[model samples]
Target: MARQDTPTNEMSLRWTVCGDRDVTVRGAEPGDVSALRRFIDGLSRESRYFRFLSGGQVGDAVVSRVLGRHDGRDIALVVTDGEEVVANAVYVVNDADEAEFAVVVADAWQGRGLGRRLIQHLQQLARAAGLRGMRGDVLSENRRMLAIVRELGFSTRRAPGDAYVQEVSLRLAAVTREAWLAHDWFQG
Candidate 1:
């Protein structure tokens, strides 16, 4: 597969998926802030809570940090259906080699592999940015994300928080350029 550098125009991406169902992944831009907000707003309450660890509310400062960080230290990708944003994934490098990741898919678009695609895309970005691995803290009740993590071969361990409350941390194996390129999920 060919990897193009991040696109300068958020809307100038060439759709790689077929059947007129456009799917292009790229870095977030200034113009995409509102669309990203709208997409986040469209997420189901359950999904929001699962991703953000809170009931459907995220502060504007957090949203802006995710959307406006064009530098490689932070990365965000938006998957659009025509003009509507349907899925999003973001990652921020925490240390020299580790990054934390989160993903959200609109309620209507769940179970079509959009979440998988977004994770794959984010993994590519993470590897490109020299991150050794990606980590995520997923709620125990979120089975969809758990399945995705397993499918991607992440080694999971229960994060030490309130043991009485349920949640687990998943750490994906080190992703190299070769490993990412060789991943079966990316092979057409």
Candidate 2:
């Protein structure tokens, strides 16, 4: 993938995925509530179910939770295409050395490796926050998300008491070094 930078400071992260499409990712801010709503609205019911593990309509409370992050113990990231949010990733850090994470990509943006990029960005952010790992529970039927997590090297186990869900986790140090090595080799 190749990247070309632009002057969007609020969304400083830029990358190329799926060959040549450019995506700019950045931390979510107060101003993104409308964008977040629009992104959620664009998702299909199945897509929302896979991400939130629910079949009902997405509530404003979910948006508020995504907006809430006063203690610095949680991180929310959004990828944009200069107009609206196309993907969202978040991790809620616990007292332990790990965090619980979740991600949702717009229906129009699926299958382009955006999910993988979001997970990688989340891993980097979690590692910087002194987190040991990041984890999330995925519905068993959500094969696409499960495959993405597995491809990124996360380990999966059955979510307790829920035969339909699988819990996935990844150790930060493990992937951190691998990412560094890849970058180092590329630069050599």
Candidate 3:
């Protein structure tokens, strides 16, 4: 996949998950820093460590980085339930043509499909940006996330230099279920 001038600025839209429930899913806006911080700070300690791999709060610079202030090639998404930020997901395209990703869902939002849906959305955005693949690093104990990505067609291996982390990756160009499922609208 070669880089093209594809616009990945997904418009803010209210998404109806099933037939009755509605959720606002949109690109991470500059004004969302406080909400994003609240979402992260509201997560359980275990979840925060799993998402950031650190006990310290993520600095404002990194938050702005993911919010795409430094690079438009990167993408971040926000999921809100009414006025509360419920989830955040992002992908940074590295020089290797692989989009490395990170996703976190609020404590109460766990067990729901928000994480999976956000990952699928990230995959679509990465594909449109001509990224060859998407990958993420998860703790060995994060069985839930491992299961989600595996079910979505990602394969995992032990991360180099780290015994407790698993590196999961999915090739976007491959003919796979997620590809069609995520972009079924134009898959002719």
Candidate 4:
């Protein structure tokens, strides 16, 4: 298979973090499955419950889908501390006009800006892939994720569902090279 060419930035890049630990965020590779599993397994029971809406583990088929390549426009990125996968963000191209997004961060790394960084990178990837907008559903009680989406300027609306089940749809602003460059969280 032909490799996708990542875009080159013409200017210097900067990232802001609230923690001391060093983190690296990059495109996910097939070989990183075990690391990804380890990180996912480390999330708190509540976090896992919130993310998957169930107690069951993330299955192999889902992992394969997350790690697979697409003939259309899509990208998946993983954040790591050396050999461990601590977070992942994915952008699934829906059409010429929009894309779908999802992100997961380990419990141990929560509240440290890794999710924000991952989303920022995902946004850059979306723009580079020529997508116009992005959207996703987040549980309403997931405040950390809500704050991240709000900080990134996504317009959110209550999702239609069983009234008792809480969730919201986050729709990001039209993705453009200039807007991505202007984002405070963008590192490259």
The candidate scoring highest on lDDT is 2
lDDT of 3 by residue, 57-176 (tens): 877776666576437688888888888988888888888999999998888878767788888878888898889999989999999999999999999999999999999999988567
Q: Which model scores highest in TM-score?
A: 2
TM of each candidate vs. truth: 0.75, 0.84, 0.81, 0.75
Give the Å shift of residue 7 in candidate 4.
11
Instruction: Order the candidate numbers by TM-score, best to worst.
Output: 2, 3, 1, 4
Model 4, backbone clash pairs (residues 3+ apart or across chains), number: 0
RMSD list, candidates in order: 6.7, 5.3, 7.5, 8.3
TM-score of 3: 0.81
For candidate 2, lDDT tens digit of each residue in 13-111? Answer: 787767777778887888898899888878999998998776567898898677548477788888888878899988898767797889898999988
Encode model 4's per-residue lDDT on 71-171: one tens digit a residue: 55777777766688777777777755566778888877777777777777777667766677778777777777877788887876677764423343344
lDDT of each: 0.70, 0.82, 0.81, 0.67
Ten contiguous residues minimizing lDDT sum, candidate 1:
163-172
Error of 1 at 91 (Å): 0.8
Q: How close is candidate 4 to the true structure, as a TM-score?
A: 0.75
Once fitted onto the true fold, the runs of candidate 1 whose alpha carbons sit more than 4 angstroms away are: 1-20, 164-188
After the best TM-score superposition of candidate 2, give how far the Cα of residue 141 lies from its true spot, in angstroms: 0.5
Choose 1 or 2, whichever is better by lDDT. 2
Clashing pairs in 1: none
Candidate 4 ranges beyond 4 A from true positions: 1-19, 70-72, 164-188
lDDT over C-alpha atoms for residue 89 of model 3: 86
